[model samples]
Structures are given as structure tokens and as C-alpha cells.
Target: MAKTIAVEYRVHDGPDALAHAAAEHFLEQAQKSVAAKGKARIAVSGGSTPKRTFELLANPKEKFLQAMPWEKLELYFVDERTVPPTDKDSNYRMTREAMLDKVPLKPEQVFRIKGELPPEEAAARYESTLRNQFKLEGAEVPRFDVLALGMGDDGHTASIFPHTAGIHELARLVYANQVPQKDTWRVTLTWPVIIQAGEVFFLIGGKDKADPLHRVLQGQYDPETLPSQLIQPKNGKLLFLLDKDAAALLPAPDASGKGKLEIQR
Candidate 1:
């Protein structure tokens, strides 16, 4: 039986506001995690919205740059394209250009998926890294302090394309997904791993995402067709930060730009 999940979302006026909200959320989660534990482990997905958020976090003018506890944070990627880290399409490259290079975080603190390697090998290596880092004994999964995600126009998230093999992955922490529609391969953290995170949120924007966002949150629960629906965190809550365009099809937000819904997983 599917469980009910209470999803909370905030809609911003525009892209800049959305980015600011995401950056603030990131900092808040990191601080909360650091206060609870000694350090914060967060996994982030790559996209235009996330890139903007990263830049905001790294910008000297922004409070997030100074407020972020870089030394006590361990950053990870939610997925990576099958390209070299230096490639233009690489998520690692985007993050480095946007935030990593400017941040005070050490190299060892960023655990990037080796997208240059063969798809299966890269997934295996990432899984091994997680196991070693989290010190998993049996079937234990790493409970990241925060997991940031992005939704595709097709209702996909974390490289788990609709009707892809990645959607069925339950035991693996990571997966090598072959996306026929894109004619490319990707290494992604599996849904199981994503759902195990302590905090899970999706940062989405753009008018192109309006329909998909509506379907993902308000439509039927068909994960095979809408992979984003598979992301039902074990903690029973999900968060969404959206720009006005993307939130257009969803229920109208209050004057405070906040909205809440209860959906079945």
C-alpha cells in the first residue's frame, strides 16, 4: 500500500527569487544538520535553477556565501552525464564553474561521479564510494542530511527517465541508466537512495515545466510514466521550490507564496 505524503511548496516571483529561496533552504538544511550531527552531507542535482542557487551560495554579496559552513559540509552529486568532468555537458563542470571553484570547500569534500568512466563502472565506483563513506554494514543506505533534486519537462528526476530501467532499481544505491530517448547514458543515484535522505526537495522553474510539475504533484501515481513520483522520501515529507511559471498549473499559493498538498506515494 502506498503511504500518504504531505508536500510543501513555495512559489517565487521569478527565477532570481527562486534561486534565493533554494540557496536559503540549502544553508538552513546544512546548519540544521551540522547542529544535529557534527557535519552535513548533501547531494545536489544539476540544472539551471540549481546552478543559480550555487552561484548565489558562492557570491560574496550574498549572505549564504559567508553563512555556509564549507568546512563541515560534504557535497555529492545526484547524477552525472556520461562525459568527462571537464566537458561542457558535465554536471561537475557546471558546479565547479558556478560554486565549487569559488567556495572554500576542500577537494576531498566534493565527491563527484566519474562520468568519464564506462557507465556501469562509474555507477559501481559511486556505489562503492557511498558504502565506504557511510560505512554501511549490510543493506544500510546513506541518509544524506539533504538531497536536492530537479524535475525534467517529462516528469523525470535524477536521470531516471520515464519507462527506463532506473525506475525499477530498488536495491542499488546508484544505477547506470541507458536513456534511449536521449541516446545517452547516465549515472544516477537510485530512487531508493534518494528516498532515504533526511531532507528531500526539488528546485524547479521555467514555463516548460508547468504541465509536468502539475502532473507530478496533482496527477495519478504512475511512476513508470512519471519517474518523479517515485521520490517519496522515507521521512514522509517533500519540498518544492518553484518559480511562478512552473507553479502556474498547481494550486494557487497564498499571499505568502506557500502551498501544501497531500498525495499518496
Candidate 2:
């Protein structure tokens, strides 16, 4: 049964402010997770918004670079384009150029989906990797300390395009979805795996996203037409870091730039 999920959002003045907010949130979550356990397992998505956040985290001039516990963090991808790591569209490549090469994190600490392989093969390999890393004995799912996501203008999230087979995938931790709209295959963590994460948040910006974002949060619970709606974390809360353009259609934030809503998942 679907339960009520508390939707919290913080509206930033612009893209730069939004990116800074996201980077700070990332650092805070990582610190909390590491304090709770010995290490933090975080999965991140790829997009322009996240790219800026990654740059901020990796910049030596930024506080995150000096404060982040690099050795105690294990990074993973939430999704990847079905292209080689060297490709322009490869999420791993973007991360490497923006953050990985500059950060103190070792190569082994980053687990990238091998997008160069066949889509199904890549998905299977990633699933096996997760099982081994998390030491899963059976049907248990790996729980990430934090999962960062991005919503597409079309209302898709983590490569789970609207009405795609990825939306119906419940048995697997990873899936190779064929996105007909984009005419490409994508390797992604399934929605079940995503919702199991300890913290789940979306970073969204641009005026183009305003309409779909409105529909995704305020419209009916229709996963087929708006796959972003599928991201209702089991913890009963979700967060959105938005720029003013993206949050235009949503409720106005308080003086502190915070807004809240509740919806049945």
C-alpha cells in the first residue's frame, strides 16, 4: 500500500546557489553516514546540475574538498548511458573530469557501471558487484547511505522513462532499459533499489522542468506518465533542491526558502 511521503524542498536563488546547496547537503549526508558506520556508500546521478555540484565538491578553493572524508566514502553511479567511459555522454567520464581526478578518493573507491559492455552484461555485472560489496546472501537489497537523483524535463528520473519496462522492474537491483524516446540503452539502479536508500534527493533546475515537476509532485499518482513519482523513499521523506526557475509553479517557500508538501506514494 502507498503511504504518505513528506516532500520537502529548498528553493535557491539561482543555479549557482542551488549547486552550492546540493554540495553542502552531499557533504552533510556523507558525514552523517560515516559517523553512523565506518564508511558511507553514496550513489549519484549525472546531469548538468549534478555536474556543477561535483565541480564544487572537487574544487580545492571550496570547503568540501578540505572537509570531505574521502577515504571513508564509496561512490557508485545511479545510472549510466550505454557508451564507453571515454564518450561524451558517459556519466563516468563526466564524474571523472569534474570530481574524481581532483578528489583524494582512490580508483577502487569508485564503482562505475561498465557502459562499454553490452547493456544486459553491464547491468548484470553491476548487480553482482553490489551483492558482493553489500554481502547480500539472498534477495536482500543494498541500502545506499545517500542517493542523488535528477529529474528530466519529461518527468523521468534515473533513466526510468515514462511507460518503459524499467518502471515495472521490481525483482532486480539493476536494469538495462531501452529508452525508445532517446533511442539508446541505459543501465540504471531499479526503483526498488533507489527507494531503499537511506537518503534520496533530486536536484532540478531550469524553467523547462517547471510543468513536469508540478505534475510529478501535485498531480495524481500516475507512474506511467510521470516516472519521477515512483521515487517515494521507504523512509517516508523526499527532498528536492531546486532553483527559482524550476520551483516557479510549486508553492512559494517561506522566508528561509523552505517548502513542504505531502503526497501518497
Candidate 3:
């Protein structure tokens, strides 16, 4: 039987506020993981909104950063574009400039997809790396301590585009997705792996995403047309951390000032 997907939401006044809340949650999860297991395994996605949160985490003078178990945190990418780490469009580059470079995480602690290689080869290699790191078996999934994701305007997340083959992968932990619309190939951790994480967060902002967020949160369960809808964490919490603009189309909040909505599947 499929585990129930219970979703909770928090709507912030704007992107900056949303970023702050996300950073706080991220640090709390990291500290809790490290205290319980001596390590925190995090898989982060690429996007402009995530950059703000990353910056907050990287700021040394910030109170949160002072006590962060930076060395005990292992960072990985949820997906990557088919580009070198130095490319302007590279996810690793964005993350490095935003947080990794500014933090004390060791070089080996940062696991990035070699997007410069063939998509298939990169995906296969990353799967092997993940399996070895987590000691995963044939049918086992590597449960990340925290999975930070961002939604695109089209409602896609982690390189899983709408109507794409990656969205339908049921066995593999990773996939090489061919997105012909943009003439680019993407290496991504498939939903099978993502849905088993310890915690999953969707950092959505801007007015452009309002309609899709509404449809994904308050509409039907259509993963093909709205890939973000596929993010149903089986054994962990699924949180939608949205800015006011992104949450604009969601059902109005009750007297408590939070647009709290629960969805079970």
C-alpha cells in the first residue's frame, strides 16, 4: 500500500521572508540529523529562490551559521543541467557561489553530478555514488535527511519536466531525461528516490507560479501535466513553503492567518 501523503503549507509575505523561514527550517533539520546520526545528507535543487536561502545559510555572521554542523553536512544536487560546473547555467556553480564556497564543508562532502558527461553516464555514475554512500540495495532508496526543491513556472521540479519520461520512472533511483523542447538533457534523481526522503520542501515564489501552485496544491493529482504534484513523500513530511505571490491563488486563509490546507492521498 502506498503511504499516505499529508501536505502542510506556510505562506510568507514575500520571497525574502520565505527564504528566512526556509533557512530556519533547514538549520533545524540539519542540527537534528547531526545530533541523532552524526551527519546530515541534503539534496538541493537549483533556482533563483533557493539562492536566497543558501546565502542566509552561508552568512558567517548569521546566528544560525554560528552553530551549524557544517562539517557533518553532506551536500548533493537533486538534478543538474548538462553543463560543466563552471558554466553559467550550472547548478553546482550556482550553489557553490551561493553557499558551499562560503561554508566549511569539505570538498569531498559536496557531491555534484558531472553534467559535462553524457547524460546516461552521469546518471548511472551518480546512482552508484548514492548507493555506495547510503549502502543501498537493489530495491532500497536512499533517504535524504533534507530534500530542498524549487518549482518552475511550468510546475516541474528537479528536472522532472511535464510529460517527460523521468516522471514515469518507477525503478531507477536516477534518470537521464531528454527535454527536446529546450534541446537539453538533464540528469535527475527520480521520484522513486525523492519520495522516500526524511523531509521534502518546495520553495515556490513569484506570481508566475500562482496558477500552477494552485492546481498542484488544490487541484487534481496529475503528475504528467504537473510534475510537481509527483512530490509525495512516503515516509516524511511534505511542506509547501510559498511566498505571498505564489500562494495568491490558493484558498484564502481562515481566522488564524495561515492558509493551512491538508491533502491526503
Highest lDDT against the true fold, candidate: 2
Poorest stretch of ten by lDDT in candidate 1 = 135-144
The TM-scores, one per candidate, come to 0.99, 0.99, 0.95
For model 2, name the residue pairs that clash: none
| Candidate 2 local lDDT, 1-265, one digit each (tens) | 7599999999999999999999999999999999999899999999999999999999989999999999999999999999999999999999999999999999999999999999999999999999999999789999999999999988999999998999999999999999999999999999999999999999999999999999999998799989999998999999999999999999999999999999976
The true-versus-predicted C-alpha distance at residue 78 of model 3, in Å, is: 0.4
Clashes of each: 0, 0, 0
Stretches of candidate 1 off by over 4 Å are: none
Q: Write the per-residue lDDT of candidate 1 for residues 83-188, one digit (tens) a residue.
A: 9999999999999999999999999999999999999999999999999999997789899999999999999999999989999988899999999999999999
lDDT of 3 at 105: 88
lDDT agreement with native, every candidate = 0.95, 0.96, 0.88
Candidate 2's TM-score reads 0.99
- In candidate 1 the C-alpha lDDT for residue 226 amounts to 94
Alpha-carbon lDDT of model 2: 0.96
